[model samples]
Target: MSLFEELLKWDKDQCRVVGKKFELGSWNKLSEKDRLGMIGELIDLLCQRLKIKDKPKVILTTLDNAFGAFSPSENTIYIDRKTLSKGGILTACYCST
Candidate 1:
């Protein structure tokens, strides 16, 4: 099965194996630089399950929530989606290695 399928299945059956909501909060509370770095690391872990690229298919609730993705290939950062005006929660789907 694909990594995405496996990860989704695990989340459905076991719920939390590697990273969960509570654990994510601790990780998210880090500094802006740290958060971005951690997110990058998390993306690596997630890649084991999916082929993640620099451009991600972002799914956002509002255009105000902060969002960014590191483009390793181009060696640059890109904003897949932005929530510049509205206010709401942001849910980013990340691939884990």
Candidate 2:
């Protein structure tokens, strides 16, 4: 299976095994626009850390079940809204990279 498909399957499995939900901090309590801005900043930090010349496109989606995924072919990163809502930006960022 493709990477995306594998990620999707993993996410589905994760949803079935629930533990304590992620906590939302003050930073995560910000407005949607502000949160997206934070995500952009995180992406910049990730690119710098990874020393990637061509930065991948970052997309936040409510439809996706996964916390985050990187598509090498599209050079894009997908982060789930649920993750951000749960104050999981750092987790998502690490996973994406």
Candidate 3:
């Protein structure tokens, strides 16, 4: 079976995390523009938490077979315009972590 299938079959509760989990209300109902705004907010929060000096610039682009990439030199994040972020805490930032 594929990895996707295995993930689907696994019980989500099997994994436990200590920190508080953030829950977004009406996630599916949010517009693309709203979602992008949320992503920006998440990034800002993360930067603050990590003590990052300059907030990384987020640029949406047309990518092939990939969701996003981070450039250290440029200090920027590039997300695939075609695939916007999903809900559930840092799912938008970390992608199912």
In order, candidate lDDTs are 0.42, 0.59, 0.60
For model 3, name the residue pairs that clash.
none
Better of 2 and 3 by TM-score: 3
lDDT of model 2 at position 1: 69
lDDT (10s digit) by residue, model 3, range 1-97? 6655643543334221211122345556777777667677766655664557899998888778878888999998988876664553335433244
In candidate 1, stretches whose alpha carbon ends up further than 4 angstroms from where it belongs are 1-4, 11-18, 21-28, 51-66, 69-90, 93-97
Q: Considering TM-score, which of the candidate structures 1 and 2 is the better prediction for this target?
A: 2
Candidate 1 per-residue lDDT over residues 8-71, each given as its tens digit: 6544322243344225455445554444554455556555445555433322233233454445
Question: lDDT for model 1, on a 0 to 1 scale?
Answer: 0.42
lDDT of 2 by residue, 3-93 (tens): 5565443443333221112224545557766777766665565466455789888788865567888899999888788876667664442
Q: Pairs clashing in candidate 2?
A: none
Candidate 1 lowest-lDDT run of ten: 81-90
Off by over 4 Å in 3: 1-25, 85-90, 93-97
Alpha-carbon deviation at 42 in model 2, angstroms: 1.8
- Model 1 — TM-score against the truth? 0.39
- Best candidate according to lDDT: 3
